[model samples]
Target: MFKEWARSVRYASKFHRKQEIVTFMRQIDDLEIYANLSKFLCDNYRQALKILKSEPELKRWMSVEGIDDYDTFHVWLEEEREYLMGMEDGLPKKREETVEMEYVKRLKNLESSQGRLSSILKAERAALSDRADFNPAPISQVACRHAVEHRNRDAELVQDLEVRLGITQQWTSESPEWILAEKSIMDHRYLDALDEIERIIVERLFEMTKIHQSGTRYKMRRHIAKALQARSKAIRNAIDRYNTVAEEMDPPKPTLSWEEVVNYGFLAEFDILRDTGDSIRSRPWTRRSYRVAMDRYFKILRAKEEIQRLNIEIKRVVTWIEDEDWFLRRKEAEYKDLNPPLAVQISRYRQRRARSDYNHMQRFWALAKTPGFTGSVVPGVSVERQQARHAERASRPQTSREMEMEVVDERERWNSSQEGEWEDDDDEGEEAEQEKVSTLMYQMSVLAVDQDDGRTHQLD
Candidate 1:
């Protein structure tokens, strides 16, 4: 009986401790801090509760002592404080002890997390070494050659597009758009860089088409031309914008335009004499040289576009994170509680408060039942046992024979249903045949009766 009383006190203490921790968490202003602490406290509470409830001695004493009233219960706990603390089986740990232990546990967990993260990094590094750090000289020789050839063709196409657009490499290098784009990237102004790229691309496309007089069979030529044009314009714009902001001088003046370069080529025609003494080349600049330059320019343009795109996407993601942080802080300040614990606290408080004004007839006759103060709450053993049984059933694995039996039962049901359907069809056919035979019999009987009547009339 005394053990049961001690167990009852332990149970009450566990409940009180949980209530206090939950209330403390609900009162906290910061959701993040509360969230971190609440889990620790809740885990401790659950462990303590489990220990207190599992004591079989408490169940026996609960029926003997009829101390169900809240006020009486608290008084009993206060009077037996020393005994309650002395019990080895169901006592809750002190707050200081619990906190100190939890701190050590968390520290160890943090160290474990760091170790795990480091191991992951090491694994990833090893994978990168195997995949990306190997020599490419032998493996990529053929592919590299093909890539170089393709790049050369693209370069030639870009050079043609530039010539048709009436712009030179020198003019693009000096353009305000190109200059601004490079400056923006250096300054880490990714949005500005993106804007510059857009402007450069649009202007180049518009001007290139305007200046274009002839069409090419290769459609890639048009795309390559536009990409190069946009890239040049964006770079110039970036430089121009950067110069204006930094108060820096503009780049050296452009030496030539597309028309000037073309006209000069025609005017300054220097003949190349071959060492063979008989064969002579007309000029130093050939179609092949221009084609090689076009390929290089195309590669440069693609690289710039990809770099600018990545920079802009990264900046946008950073901005979104910042906005989300601000929003959460604002909401936290504006509301009393924005998380689950606060809601739970409010509901719990309301439920307890609602029971405050109740007048129990049983309490009034409490003195009559003073010798036997039993608790209203049943020991949760039966309930836990039932739950365990349910969990076991749910988790139990089915044998292969059981699975086969189930399949067999399903097939049998399906076969029976098919047989039922066939029987119904047979019954309908039999019913139709019976009706046809009955009709024929009735027709014959009527004809016979008619013939007999006719004979009698004739005899008369």
Candidate 2:
């Protein structure tokens, strides 16, 4: 009966059928039957340990668990048995021992994979931040999101100017300055016309700023400043229209900052537009309009030449950013989806270690039952390994038949060799037999003549 149960347990453990093993054990009622099986299990445990002791990894495991001596090993066997029982009852405790280097290696690989993913995500974020077009501004200022809005407004103003220039609408009225500006643009005298407008605005602004005013002079200056402001606004509107069409046809592109281009030639004359908040000395609105017009003029000039180049640069940056964004997202997804194979490794190690521990327990119980059995009992031989070694030795080729086959194989191999001198005597047998007849004729001549006679005959 015990033999039958032992066979079932062996089959169950061998095939990883844990439930089946439990089912077989549960069918037993007799305490003696359990005892007998337990003894057998102990014997098997000792057998397995003896076989595994020679393996370096298993030896390291023994050292790690402090199972060096038989007494300590026996104590460990008891603990393992209880742990296995606990697993069968309800709660399964996972083995957290770092004894297996393979488990550690798997953990390291998972970390490395995740680390690479982090690097990709970080690079993508950096690329996103590097975009010059994505500017966010304060309550008082402009932002990147407003670029299209500003562009559209500029385009509409340009369209309005085009309608006025062509007199496309029946009810449209044209100002003389606007008409003159339009004619200059058509005639390709853009520089002359633009300069003339800029000169008129600048002269008026210079006069207003230079005026040293008492009460009457101040009043007169204020009136003149009001007229200058109105004129500057009208000229700026025309320039804005011209700039809009110029930008749409060939837009100006800036790689870093357009503020430099906008602020460059206007900085010194721009002080009049600064808000000093001093009511007594507040600069007129006309001065502000002139300054803005000057800035617009510079922007239009710069755009007329470099719009396409700036567009190409912006496109390149935006495209690179988009590519990086996609790559980063892909890496992030991979990271999120990362499921390390460490679980599988852990399962495998647990299965093997459980097998080893169970066998050790069975051996300890067997030793306990034996009369006068001491903890000093040590396995002198690994029966399973010895059998395996014998099996391996038996499978190897040997003796006369094998040697003859090897010789035939060698002959086949040697037949392909080009060098004649490397051939063995057996291989050169025909050549040696052919050379024997020539050697025999030479020997007969030597025997027929004395040493001196042979020498003299050879010389003649």
Candidate 3:
């Protein structure tokens, strides 16, 4: 019996301790604190949504809980507050001993309801915080915007260059060099296409340089170079913008580390006794602030990607230009070395040969017009003998094999005659004949050079 009495006393002591703990919890009004926090979270979420709605571009970046949940929680909080106010109003005007137990029971039920509501509020706040922390939609939206802007800017710069070059026709296909290069590519002559493009670029550079030297108004190279400079400036501007946004959006670090905030309460264990600390104190950012920061961060990433691509493209073109410039300089030096003296000789030779040909033609015509003329117009040849020889040769009948052999012999004789023509000339005439041969060679070279120049001008 004494042991049973001792066990009852132990149970009574435990029950009293639990009652004191409950009373202390109720006095702190943790239920009200949780409700206020939930309301604060709801307000922030609503404000963020409003801002997102105003900016359609930014709307795609927000990922959060639905408004209906917040609405429901708010309605419940309001109803519970009204019920508590009504209960306070209905409290007896005079403290009646007979109604004390009833009042106590009603108060206990209200406390229980408050406890349940506080738990619900705490759960809601946790959900909202988790959503705010983890969403990446804002970052994705910023990155997409950055990439789009960069692409548009690049296109605009390219269009401007095209306009300035007067090659703005659709696809810029009207440029003869481009057309030839494109045709070569279509023909599966990749090396030819590359050569054509390189040649055109070198020619343009050379022409521009010549124009500059002559103090002319040629601006094609200047425009192209300007566009390249703009591209470089755009890259720098993008990088600067990215850096500025990053600095602007970067939030100050929280006083407490994440580990500390999670492991210990806002005020450590003291928060439990005081019950006045807020969970939000541990976090540095709200949902909207965090999202905006992430957006800027992602924008920086996209800018970096675009900058890298631009750098590669610009570097490739610049390298090609440098190589073409070197090639152009070398070719110009070669042309200067070989053309001037040779061209002067060829020109003088052509004038003399033309006069000689005219005189020979006039003499031949005059001799033909003479009534009794029988001699060949050509020097050292008899016309009658030449005609008789041709007639005898034509009259001779021969088998196909003999005919073929005769044709071969004729070719050999013609070749030998041409080879001995200069050798048969007297020493006094030898130098003149050699000059004629050299003039013929120079004519062929001039014709080829003229054709190439014509083609190059057509390309221009």
Best by TM-score: 2
What TM-score would each prediction reach against the true structure?
Answer: 0.13, 0.15, 0.14
- Candidate 3 error regions (>4 Å): 1-59, 63-297, 300-305, 308-460
Q: For model 3, how does the per-residue alpha-carbon lDDT over 208-284 read when each residue is reduced to its tens digit?
A: 45545755544765765565455545434433443343333224111222233224311122222121122222422
- Clashes counted in candidate 1 amount to 28
lDDT of all predictions: 0.38, 0.40, 0.39
lDDT of 1 by residue, 187-298 (tens): 3332233233333333444445544646543565667666766665545555456335333323322222233322323211211112112111332122334323333333
Which structure is stronger by lDDT: 1 or 3? 3
Clashing pairs in 2: 42-362, 42-363, 45-359, 229-286, 251-307, 252-307, 253-310
RMSD of each: 43.2, 44.2, 47.1
lDDT of 1 at 374: 16
Tens-digit lDDT string for candidate 2 (1-460): 6676567567445556677666656655323353354355445434433433344544454466454543443443355345334434332222232222222233334445545555655655676688755333363133323443544554455445445445443221254544444443332333333333334435544455555444547677777778766775655664564354434332231121223223334323434223222221242222444334333433434443343343233334323322332233334334432532443343333333334333333344344333322121111223443464356459974544234324433533443352344235563464334234323432442243235333543664
Compute the lDDT of residue 218 as modeled in candidate 2: 65
